[model samples]
Target: MPLSTRQSVIIALIVASAYFMENLDATVIATALPHMAATFGVTPVGLSIGMTAYLLAIAVFIPISGWVADRFGQRSVFGGAIVVFTGASVLCGLSNGLVEFTVARILQGVGGAMMVPVGRLAVLRSTEKHHLMRSIAYITWPGLAAPVVGPALGGFISTYFSWRWIFLLNVPIGLLGLALTATFIPNYRASTHRPFDVSGFVLSGVALICLMYGMELVGQLHSDWRITVAALTCGAGAAALAIRHLGRAAHPLIDLSPWRIPTFRVTLDGGSLYVVSVSVSPFLLPLLFQLGFGLNSFAAGLLVLAYAAGNLGMKSVTTPILKRFGYRNVMIVNGLLTAATIAMCSLISPSTPRVLITLVLLIGGLCRSMQFTGINTLAFADVPPARMSSASTFFSMVQQMTIGLGIAFGAIALHAAVLVHGNHAQLSLADFRVAFLLVAVLVLISVLYFIGIEPDAGREVSGHTRTASR
Candidate 1:
């Protein structure tokens, strides 16, 4: 049965809430690293294992999500995912050592890998064509807002309360999501099922894990460049092999047919650029404040509030903007502005007025929100209903891979600047400037892709008609 409007709304809300819990769990650890390290008796960098393990686990499992959900009912898998994630969160909060925590994180990743992609699949299946833009916008906020505010929120909690609360807080949210899922989310499975592609899963998992972990390696300032290069090379090769196999295999784990769709293809290309570039700001901005401007953790996190505020502040107007300007125009213009705003950071230094900095970040956030909404809305507009699950899985995998790539690229930019300038000591403002400029250039490349999008693209989803004046 096609979902009624109220039912669709419930599904979107339930899925968004679940994703918020998942994303918040993934991101909130950013600011609590110091406290966690102290308690675990390790360097701050050493604690990254917890984060990387979770990411690698997610990347490894995400490719199989669609198939798994199709084999089992979505309701069963979704509920199980929440249970696993929530239980893992509790275990993470209780961990006393790095090994224990890393293990728990991987378990959490198993749940999250299933949780996010399947939830998205549910929304795509339930939402009507006309309401896709709003449903997509609803789901996207948790993905954006959680990461944006996670550092600040984490810093506050760790400073005043305990880092344990970061994970423990998920219990209630997860319970609520689980309850709502049972009441509101419908069970769905593919009618025609094929044998599981164990080899494909193996190859894709290896590719994603190596790529993401390699990036994590690149981020470590003191790591061996040789190992980093090797891991990245292997990741590239495995990815190539995986793609070839998926394209050729009759029962491939990941169905790649959806990439043939022009709208989906272009959105992926353009979205990758935005993801890689913006990925830097979150990791870089807090550091720039702390290392360059000499702000403490609490103050640095608070400073990032401007960026987070900017990220969320534009949400209310995104739908209207897309409706008025259309997806293509908004993406090209808004994406360019977002990139430009990132480059504008080069102008910020110790002497820059605080208010001016906040204003710039606020504007940047607004631009980014609009760009993401346009891309996400337009992505699924042309996808066939039968292929929705496959499209969701492929899209999620791409997002995971590119975000990992962005982090690595951000790390490399900083490392490159440090090496070039012979700043063998502390990172100076000059290093951050180099990183920002390079990443911004990467973002500008996305505009070239966006230019190729046809006029009146995604009109049905955005309600933008060719006859109407902007």
Candidate 2:
């Protein structure tokens, strides 16, 4: 039976709730690391191992999520993942030592890896083609808001309350999600069963593990040069092998058929780059306000709220705008406008008016939210029903990888700028200028990919038609 519009929107919101919990958990921990380290009797840097354990678990497990969901059924797998994640949160809050905390985090990562992709798969399965724009918009907001909101929320919680509350808070949310999942989500499974591809899983796992770890290393200022190079080199080599094996395998772990569609290909190629570029702003903006403008952390955080507001502000109009402009036009025009705003950040200084800075960030945030919705929605617009699982899985993998790399890219750009200016002692406004410019150029480069798309691409989902050029 086809789902009603109301039913599809409800399911999308349910998945969005899950996505919010996952994204918030990933970032909220960052601010509480010092407090967590104090409880564990270790330095802040030492406690980073707990995060590493979590990320590695995610890297190793995500490639196989589709297969697991197919074998066990989406509801069973997704609901079980929530149970595991919620249970792990409780264990994390009660941990007495670093080892126990690390173990709990790994469990959380496993649950997160399965929860995200499978939950999204469930949404895709339930939603009709024409309603995809609204469905994707519902799910995209959490990702835009979480990065801006997490640190401030974590700091507030840690200041007045216990750092443990961060994890414990998820208990109520997870339970709610579980109940909703059980009630609304269907037990969807593939019609035909395919054997698990163990070899493909191992190869892809190694590739993602190395790739993610390498990006992590590069983001750290004091990481060893040789290890970073080796990790990246090994990741590239493993990725090549994994691609080769997946191409020839009888039942590949992740189906690569979606890449054949132009709309899907644009998301994987251009959309990934766009994500990487936009992600740099959040990483760089706080530094720019604090380091360049001499503002306190709280003040800088307040400024970022404007950006978040812009993100949320766009949600109401995203569907109508896409319906009005279509994907290709929206991406090309909005993408350039977004890049221009990013570059405009480079021009900001102490003398720049506060209102002006906020306005720029607000505009940038609005453009970013629109671009993300368009790219993500267009990805599956042309994907067939049979290939939906593979397409969603593949999209999730690329999204994770690009988000991780975005932070690393920002760090590298800032470091390079510092070196050029010969300011090893302290960073200056000049450094941020160069970094913002580089990131803007990256966003602009992604525009070319959008240009390759047909003007009427994704018209079915957007409900927009291009008139003949008379």
Question: TM-score for all predictions?
Answer: 0.97, 0.98
Point out where model 1 deviates above 4 Å.
Answer: none
* Predicted candidate 2 versus true structure: per-residue lDDT over 1-470, tens digit per residue: 34888888888998898888888878777778889899999998999988888878878888889999998899999999999999999999999799999999999999999988898888888988888888988999999988888877887788789999999998999999999989988899987998999989988998999999999999999999999999999999999999999999999999988999999999789999999999888789988999999997668888988888888899989888878877888899999999999999999999999999999999998999999999989999999988888888888988989998999999999999999999998889999999999999999999999999988888888888775211
lDDT of 1: 0.87
Candidate models: Cα lDDT each: 0.87, 0.89
Q: List the residue pairs that clash in candidate 1.
A: none
Worst 10 residues of 1 by lDDT: 461-470
Q: Candidate 1: TM-score?
A: 0.97
| Reference-based lDDT, residue 76, model 1 | 84
lDDT per residue as tens, model 1, 1-470: 34998888889888888888888877899879999999999998889889888888899999999999999978889899999999999999999999999999999999999988999899888888788887887788788778778888998999899999999999998898899999988898989997999889989988998898788888888888899899989999999999999999999999999889999999998888888888778888888999999999778877777877776778778877788888888888887898889899988998999999999888987887777778787889999988888899999999988877887788889989899899979899999999999988988999999999988899988888766634
